[model samples]
Target: MSQTPLQEIELYAFASNSAQFHLTPHEFDVDLGGTVYVSTPIERNELALGAEAAKSALELKLPQTCDLVRHLLANALTGDTTAITLRIARRDPWGDTWWIAGTRWMGRVLGVEVADDGARVRCESAQVSLKRIGLRRLYSRTCSHVLYSAACGASPISASAIVSGSTGRSVDLDGGVPGSVSGGLAGGWLQTPEGARHMIVSETGSGVELLYPATIEPGTEVLLTAGCDHSTATCASRFGNLDNYGGFPAIPSKNPFSTGVF
Candidate 1:
């Protein structure tokens, strides 16, 4: 019997917040020739110590798009390399698989080199240690599901939810009804036409402030969806999404203190 030929290879790029990029095939490539490091000490001849951790690097050719550049720049500015998780997948005639060589390298863009022709951007990234991912809750969340990325099975949000606004760090939305949003939409985001979403820092009567100073073209149309603050009341009353709430609201805030030490 003939073996199934490898048909397709794909690379998945994610932003610092796990927001996936719907990039086309032409935008990137996955190099399978990268090295995987395992720290084994050489003591006796052909004898070695236990493995410490694995290290891998990925090189990507990202197209020069407005949204992609912003996402990369945000990583550069914040020194946040923990959020990126590159999953290389391979597809044979009958099956599809991931983690190309049995590992998922999660890391940030260490350096980005722009082509002189200004047509493409290239980046190099190193894998982050597994310990950090656990401590920061970067991948494995204690919550039930990932926010925004999970399948909520809800109907599509209407285009009417797309609010027009003046471009700036703080956008003033036109016809924004006061109290329309419950508990304010802090930690939410405003999405650009190019699929870039900036987190909302605060919401006022006129507008909302973005967590970063994003590039806003004049007369740019941005979309915003109200977000809950993850409080039990907000999840239950405001969104009726208590079942999906990621916080442990019932957990006691104060530690048990005794009047005297034993």
Candidate 2:
């Protein structure tokens, strides 16, 4: 079939383990390169040889109203590797919808630059080969229960976890499962009624502080999930989901003194 001509582009960012977002950019530029060989004296006028590896980079100038830029900044501050998808779309002559070609890659936010002219935000990122890296835990294991929210196929709570009180930075919750909600769920999420998600930083008694302050009204219905510290016992006992555990619980904690110098 004949393909339609290119018409538009769409960018999406999935950061901090949340849902995807459609990001609008005022200026978007991409650099695509490949590793090639060329010697100065011998092949000065000739093109480089065939490529062995590929490299890609993206730079965007976006409006300050775009929240994805802030999300990218937060990810940068927290050392998160988030995946970004860029779609090249073509207007289908036969229909109203556009046909899209997508390139998905994991990348880090290299920098976030601000301009004095109006409220424009600029950022740079480079492609990451996530598949090339082997599977490993990003953080050390803890004994807390793991959190699997609705986005991860965990069932929704019937009762409202939100209560009618807040300290502008913290929220009090009610109607949580007796043993399910606790301090162990510190890093989990609480999805608000407006579909915005906030991360739980620390929990004490009935109050929970978010990583960043959020504007949530009183009596709003919210959903809460537990957070896991990636321990074997918590996986098996608390969540009963040990089959999916990927950590080495039996690994030695001390180095092997094979030389016997001590």
Give lDDT tens digits, candidate 1, residues 78-149: 344434444545643344422353334445555544443222333233434443445543222233333343
- Each candidate structure's TM-score, on Cα atoms with residue i matched to residue i, is 0.44, 0.49
Model 1 per-residue lDDT at 207: 68
* lDDT against the true structure, each candidate: 0.47, 0.49
lDDT of 2 by residue, 1-262 (tens): 9996546644344445643454433143322232111111110012123331113444455543346655654443334555554444445678555454554333444555433332222222342444447643433444222245222223322224766667755787664332556645565566777656566667757667765556677788787655555577766765676666655566656656864545
TM-score of 1: 0.44
User: How many residue pairs collide in each prediction?
Assistant: 0, 6
The reply for model 1, stretches above 4 Å from the true place, is: 1-69, 72-145, 151-168, 177-183, 252-262
- Best-performing candidate as measured by TM-score: 2
Query: Which residue pairs in candidate 2 have backbone atoms (N, alpha carbon, C) closer than 3 angstroms, thus clashing?
Result: 145-228, 146-227, 146-228, 147-226, 147-227, 147-228
